[model samples]
Target: MKLPNPFRKREYQILTPATKVDDSILERPEFLPEEEVKRSGKKTAAKQKKGKQLEGLISYLRKPRAEEGYTVLIAACIAILFTVFAFFGMIQAAGEPSLTVSAAVMSAMLVSAYGIYLAVRALRDKEKDQLYTWVGLSLSSLVMVTWVIALLLGLTT
Candidate 1:
């Protein structure tokens, strides 16, 4: 009879001894110690610097024909505002076409039309960024569509 040795490796299996690890490698580094800590606002300074950089970039992007952009922005604001007001007015009136509701809707349509015109003008400017211009145009177009639908419904009823 053959006796098997406990430390002998089997033919179909392989094993390796574990290697020693350094304490430095095993331990995680700690945060800044209390003695080394200071009252410097480094994080705030970095955030402010980043904010200034973003502001500068935005100003640079908006450098061309700024007035047209402003107009488009104003018109878009007015259109959207009046459109919402008119919608609420209509709802309050219970679908009744009151003069105030009609006026609000008309104003919304006019402002949206103006916004579209300003957007088109901005688009024609060779150096304009056109980001706000496109946004204004889309918003105005949406208001205009909404007004038209309201008008059509009013006419039908």
Candidate 2:
């Protein structure tokens, strides 16, 4: 004899789609007519135009004034001067008998890498201020100065 059925299954009746349902009965009585829909479309267009005008006014009010060019020029000058000094120092060091060429080269490389990183970051951040740009440019110029000095000293010997 088979052991009493260990598992009992529940029986469910299959459902068929309702043939008596009327789809029209589900619609609301306040349905918009075609003309009303067109009128609503026109209203939306007018609203969008008004929105754009408001945005234009807001932007004009919030826009920043032009920056002073002199500030940028000064920053650039400072960057250039520093770069020149750094380069001269590197060159003088290289020319000295006790200085190691490897250290000079490494310092130059580090300055160059750091300059590039700063420049890229400033650009990505949309930094319109000339200060960051000047700093980055100065750092990059310093790298060039160091490299040139090392080369000059190496060749002079």
Candidate 3:
């Protein structure tokens, strides 16, 4: 029988012949010694530095405050007062009948238009204060419209 080939055997084996490696390839250079690296550590100088602060006196300017709520309240109140006045004026004008009726109607329409304009402006802007403004304006407009219509129909004064 023929002998089995050693290369074909299923077993671990060393392929290369043993030889001495060059010291330069196998070891770190002399300049990059472990002692010097350990002594230097990993600390950075930039991280240890402090930032600058403002030195001289400074003045800050602010804008004037707006009384949006007060404005809205005043507007609504004015519309209401005007409506009341118009109602009374119409009642007094009733004696003259045809003479002052058109004038009273025109005044009422104007007030109602102003209120509607305010309400529309407030509704278009999404700010919280403006939202409240719009609501107040809308309510005032509705009141004025209702009273004006009633007056024209001769239902109320």
Candidate 4:
């Protein structure tokens, strides 16, 4: 029995090269020319030591990627911790100078400053994403400004 086909055939064409290609273009040579190999021999001890010395710094700088960098993320987290400390100090205030609260506020300030530093560093890195960096910087700046205003008001009274 003859049946009607529901789908039509899709037309396509296959292509072939007119001439043979060079094998060298397709494969890597076992040995390169002297001029092509800039550093043919093993690295000297001094160069190896220098590389080892800079390894830590290089890795730290390399953490910045196409996505948000780790330093900026860490800065944001630190700023959040500063906010927590600030709120805790405010809530636990005894209306008098408390050593623990004073310490907390100071520590929070220092940590937030460090967070701002990290954010600035991350922002300076051209390879890193700046969204988190800006967030961290703004939050830290806001908290610092508020703290300064509060301190001023306290001194005025």
Q: Candidate 3, clashing residue pairs? A: none
Against the hidden reference, what TM-scores do the models get? 0.56, 0.32, 0.39, 0.49
Give lDDT tens digits, candidate 3, residues 1-157: 9888888867655886455542343333334566654565412222232122233434344432223534554666665666666567667866554545555555655655665666665555443345446555766677676766666787645
Error of 4 at 20 (Å): 13
CA error at residue 69 for candidate 3, angstroms: 6.2
Sorted by TM-score (best first), the order is 1, 4, 3, 2
2 or 4: which has the higher TM-score? 4
Order of the predicted models by lDDT, top scorer first: 1, 4, 3, 2
Name model 1 segments beyond 4 Å from true: 1-65
lDDT of 1 by residue, 1-157 (tens): 9899988886653575344432343221233343333344444555676798887664553456545777787788899889888879878989775898779888989999999988887787776566778878888999999878866886998
Kindly report which residue stretches of model 4 are placed more than 4 angstroms away from their true locations once superposed.
Answer: 1-69
Give the lowest summed-lDDT range of ten residues in model 3: 42-51
Clashes in predicted model 1: 0
lDDT of candidates 1 onward, in order? 0.75, 0.53, 0.55, 0.63
lDDT at residue 8 of model 2 (Cα atoms): 68
* Alpha carbon lDDT at 90, candidate 3: 64
Give the lDDT of residue 51 in candidate 4: 84
Tell how far residue 54 is off in model 1, in angstroms: 22
Question: What is the alpha-carbon lDDT for the whole of candidate 4?
Answer: 0.63
